[model samples]
Target chain A: MAQQPSSDGTAGLRELGEFGLIDRITASVARTENGTVALGPGDDSAVVLAPDGRVVISTDVYVEGRHFRRDWSSAEDIGHRVAAAALADVSAMGAKPTALVVGLACPADTELSWLDGLTKGLADEAITAEAQIAGGDVSRADVVFISVTALGDLAGLPAVTRSGAAPGGVVAIAGTVGNAAAGLAILSRGFRSGKAYIDAHRRPQPPYAEGPRAAEAGALAMCDVSDGLLQDLGHIAAASGVLIDIDGSAFEIEPRMAEIASALGQDPRAWVYGGGDDHALVAAYPDRSHVPEGWRVIGSVWPVPDGGEPAVTIDGEHPEISGGWGHFAG
Target chain B: MAQQPSSDGTAGLRELGEFGLIDRITASVARTENGTVALGPGDDSAVVLAPDGRVVISTDVYVEGRHFRRDWSSAEDIGHRVAAAALADVSAMGAKPTALVVGLACPADTELSWLDGLTKGLADEAITAEAQIAGGDVSRADVVFISVTALGDLAGLPAVTRSGAAPGGVVAIAGTVGNAAAGLAILSRGFRSGKAYIDAHRRPQPPYAEGPRAAEAGALAMCDVSDGLLQDLGHIAAASGVLIDIDGSAFEIEPRMAEIASALGQDPRAWVYGGGDDHALVAAYPDRSHVPEGWRVIGSVWPVPDGGEPAVTIDGEHPEISGGWGHFAG
Candidate 1:
């Protein structure tokens, strides 16, 4: 997405070449005290500790136009966003991230400082998640694309799967949904004054530590809100063979989002229900008491009758919104 | 690369959408008897067994125009080649590949059948290496790019790194070099008559099992011939602080390549020495007696003199190769 003219006085990636960029990148990042990554980049492959006997892995791809625009977001923001998208998957599995590897394809003419900024941003998030940026690969392409794979350890606990939700379970969510979508809405209308919303869209701060806390609190099923709350909860319902009902009244739209929605002639509640990339953690617990702090109970689960399909509903009826469910096209 | 008209009656990726493409791709692959992947796609993340307490991981990105061409190579061949590139890195670590994850970014208009072919090809190599295609992600992009991350288990063995080469060590290779480069050469000239070379260009058959064998046989240092033998051996020399000498007379070029080269007015031996993508295993052993079966001794190692830099030589002298050493650019 960095189709902009270079403002960097120094040489860009084309001048540095792949090896030079890799060397500069590796030299910049500091190794953590944590020994998760036994061997980082520069070798044929990275060696990561998987002391819990298993590794939780997930991959996500981000493209130029489909994921982000260089004009709207900085290279660092794009990096953090892409890394969050992948790392959140690991966190949602009730695991502690150990390492993440990146695969980047961009035009050879890309700015060296911009690529460095992206790498630094990725490292920032990895450090926050207590994970190491273990390794990466780079290739030349006409358009930019980044693919990140995160590996996590369960810390000797079984993974919390989506199929474990049961009837009578309380559904809860930690962190905000619709903030990113609302932010995207703000950015789409050619407005930049909404700093909070725009920043939320730039780099979503997923409650990474909350996932394992929810698992330890005896949550049955869990997932991250990448595709909005209702759409993602639908996954749990289908897998757990249970009917999930969300209280539409549970959503409390922020004052700023509401004010902006009114000005934009959009519904703020729809953003709460259908916006994606908030990276919020959602789980179904045995009861309200099992839900951890920072996670609020928003719904309940019920059994599916024979020949009945598992589904999600808002207040005993299907919910409708004026706009479609996804706002992640930013 | 798949910008061509779709001949398949089935709906393409654009019509199917990302989720649908994922479902179809996952459904087509079979699980092996091995219990490497504790959980496959469908949940938030995949669970892969890393019983050895550590995992060796590597990633590689293959773009359509830079790494492959639709008219030159089939989707299946591209898949196999990309898989081999990453898996070989794991093997070079003397680890057994357990699982691999894929990150694909291509135009939504890409054909589903073609993608299936790529998936099948990836599965083919995974199955061969006794590994699984545990998970993958899909995204919309202007061009096609495949990023594969391979995870491997060392089975409690120490990794055989490039820094282990020592003076008096014997250099050996388990597979051919230059065949892939020669194949690409033939294909680039619009000649498909060189079936062996053309097939090598399409799919590289790396000796995956030999990696662990070399480790078990006490290989002092090891790596896969990715950037060609001379260039890759240069890595060992640099890392180990040793001088490597390849016996030019040891290389035996195949008659078929020589015949094609004569017809094409090219040097087949140059391909044998400098061509890449053969995915051959190169190692330095204590002596010729320590070399494993199917691996031939090709050279020797020596110490770098004080104030002298580590280097590679041919027949006790520096050798010049006509053209470049990259056969992997195809």
Candidate 2:
């Protein structure tokens, strides 16, 4: 919706207008000279060369209050987190991310500087993943909302779907698990912590290269830990018609997570098992010895017993913990 | 922004919850067996086969109350309109749309049936365009917002960019113009005409097949008229260093638009020149004889006057009407 002109004489989005903002944002975006991008932004559509003849595509949406609060995280943090989450999905499919198309909506009063920072963050993450910012659309909304569609190159490898895990496979994980969840808890409690856990919540660095490495190492199935380790692994278990059992003793909790949990009078294990948004890659391998170097073997896959449901278990028992992040449930 | 549980027990989104609502919405989406989509929804990311080794990508965002008011349009209408708008961009690039990935954000109190209708609308549009609904993401927001990314195949043709127009080219248009604007005007007056014009505003059917045909016929430059004729053409004119001059007499204004304009005591020419969202394909042909069958030759391109501004003119003179839609300007 259109808003009244700012009477305070501040330069707002309404003053800069849509085309002006687009020009500014596009000009600021760093364009990498990648051969995969046949045609970049400034056109109606971008043409990307899918060298392997196939493209891996995924989309994710982030709402201002629901996914992140402007009061809690900077615009750059939000942009980086959103880009990482979307790219991680492509990585989970064992694809090399190529480009990203962003769709953003914000209130008319938003500052141009905020958009500049957001674009820089998007470019920064895209560069880190060796992907380019292809193109994007901007619109007006009540609050800031971002939607990212990531495109990836599979490099001629078969996609690692959730249904590929076998009963004899060993489950492994790369990257941290519960630091983001702990950071979120600390922030929700109105406490400011300068620990790495707080930054993990603000910006998650997914194990990008580890996905394809696992795929090359003969990984049977893989997924990113966006909805907690147990919940995400449960999806693989259900799809593969197998049981996934995690050994609690195999997990070595980070000292930062332990300290934060102790300060909050909570168990760090819950955060490791039930926390979401870490964007860690968890994969299934037929043999533990064949697991990639960076991955830690934390569990094993088993056949579903007779008519019993394919489930996830901790230390040979069902844990009394609730499922990970559900937007409506929360 | 989670909403309180509906005390009236009307089966709101909160009651259905995120996963349940996702299942319901996803199940309703129609799946067409297209070879381009190697893998569809239900995975972390979809795998699409880019047989031509290149893919065309574009994205658009639609915010409720800003882009479309619920009181003015049904959920199905909103879905169809958003899909068409995104696909039209790919079409403008002389590509055949192959797939769409939707990202939706809504409040927790949304109705389940509404989402079903929305999903149906998306599927209907995708099927009509011969594209598959590859995958999507859903999240909670304070209000309804949709982001659609469209992927397309070029069928081995070189992409037609806006900067390719030459001085001797003829400007042509496919599909109608100004009907949507007239419809909006009539609706704003609280009058329900139930005419084609009103329906055009609610759901625009872009000329998808004409894009590739125009390219085959040797169109030099092309674009979709989403931001009105003059404004969109201005982009081409500026990019190509050419001036486009329209022959006002060549435009055959539909009787419906004329009637609506007469009722509101407004000139229909203004709507024809300044209307947006019609998604009409405007192109520059080397000659008028080369224009496709469904296209009407409305104007001709000329070399920019020495040191003068690149512009659009009507009947060899500059018009006095305001330009088309701007998100912030509105």
Candidate 3:
């Protein structure tokens, strides 16, 4: 296998060639979507089926310096991160991912092999989600931009929305929360270099199938931990006319999470409450037992008594982890 | 309705906010599809149907200062242009557009109102195609980047491929060609000053419905004139193992084309033969009468003699225009 070249190389995009790079990237991917994909990649457009009569879609873009820094992450890792972000949206909708289309933009200085590695990472994640890499576009730009659109099938379940949670429902999480946040802090603190923190930033292993499972299990409301657990849950609280209470004691920091907390000399609570990009699924189920994936029960939903603003309280107190991931705030 | 403010406005993307901008942009856009859209925008993902049990998709990206200049094109125009480019790919495959997902990256200095206007343009184009603007992602970057993916339904037609044309087939076109090229020249040479040239640069109106018409009319090979007539037709010829011959008399250039040529003292053939972004449908049909609405006969497809290279020729000779647009040539 030809290894991806480093960006430090002076060869521009034209030197690498467009069609040649595309062929290299697409060579590793395989099409397997139960005949719903009439046409896969390499055509003007690809065709897939809405076999269940409905299709679900979401799109996301990741820029080179803003979303991912080449100094901090590998091309493969960036591809995985981008794919995870888009797929997490699909999962949050209580849908099954079926396909993904990606658009790539890079400076002329980009190498063909780097793109090939990115494609591999993207395809691997798609396969893990039981989806196919349907199609994509490529062009030249000053920096790299990765745009992904993930399509999904609802499978006959009424989408469990952020606005659907009723008072008295149980608040739970189906995957790691704050892992990516902790990872971010670890990277920023320059404390330690470990594969765990690297993977958290590079490729978040979101519980892909848990979304449909949660919907089937009667999740009243749900969202992924893209914007921190409490911040995201607050969106549900506002939408569903309820208050979500987080049991602070219920939080159990995983080894990686604990490691980051110790190194940074910070409480894991901050990361747990305010960290983003873990892509963990947070949902409210009518009955705690109905929560699939053995998700830990964290708290319960409460009605905002007599017209008060919706909020999220951690053990009767508001935990502080300021605004989550402001785009332009210095 | 408030008019979109320029990027220098007080309420910018980083100020008026992410969710707030999204709400403004998504307002008033139609979400209904052919009952094939399972889930519409506003969630993690939207779902649609690919009735032929397959899905066709394509993506393209445009960046500020590369594909378009912010000083020249309005945000709304940029949105429209992006959609047109992607939609042309679906039309090239003889498919009906179903949905569009856009990814936008803008600087913090970008006005929130401008983003809204850009969304309006995208939604308007989506409505024009009777497709839904499903979902998208926004990120903060130094330069504005727009990525679009167009999903289409093939409806059981064996994709009329560029490689499928046969010898002795009539070549025809549906919709205007060379106008966009002429407009480009006018803009480049500082010829035309107002709406006509600007409109050509901002929004391209391809014969959207004629794609399926050509497919139904038994077009053996087809593609949209995105990369100029002869160059695009050259793709068909090279793919189909046939020689494509064009007659100059068959072409009907707009009056502005000659004006543009005269101003630059360059042949109008450059615009007709090498120009792109026209989005006109070009196809080879066995019978001329099978040509669909707005289409005119222009050339014929002939078998390559004794295994010579499948090529494009004009009036029994190979004529040259400025080479087609190359992404990284600059």
**Which 10 successive residues of model 1 chain B have the least lDDT summed?**
B321-330
What TM-score would each prediction reach against the true structure? 0.95, 0.96, 0.92
The list of candidate 3 runs beyond 4 A from truth reads A1-11, A30-36, A254-259, B1-10, B28-38, B49-53, B193-198, B252-255
Which runs of model 1 end up more than 4 angstroms from their true locations?
Answer: A1-9, A305-307, A322-330, B1-9, B31-33, B322-330
Per-candidate DockQ vs. reference: 0.53, 0.66, 0.54
How does chain B score by TM in each prediction?
0.93, 0.94, 0.91
For model 2, the DockQ equals: 0.66
What does candidate 1's lDDT look like per residue over B79-189, in tens digits? 999999999999998998999999888776677777888888999988888889888887777789899999999888899899999999999999888889889989989
The candidates, ranked best first by lDDT, are 2, 1, 3
> lDDT tens string, model 3, B24-126?
5566355424454655656666666666655667888888887887766687887788888898788778888888877788897787667766877887787
Candidate 1 residue A162 Cα shift, in angstroms, is 1.0
TM-score: the better of candidates 2 and 3? 2
Q: Write the per-residue lDDT of candidate 2 for residues A256-287, one digit (tens) a residue.
A: 67877898988888888888778999999998
Better of 1 and 3 by lDDT: 1
Candidate 3 CAPRI-style tier: medium
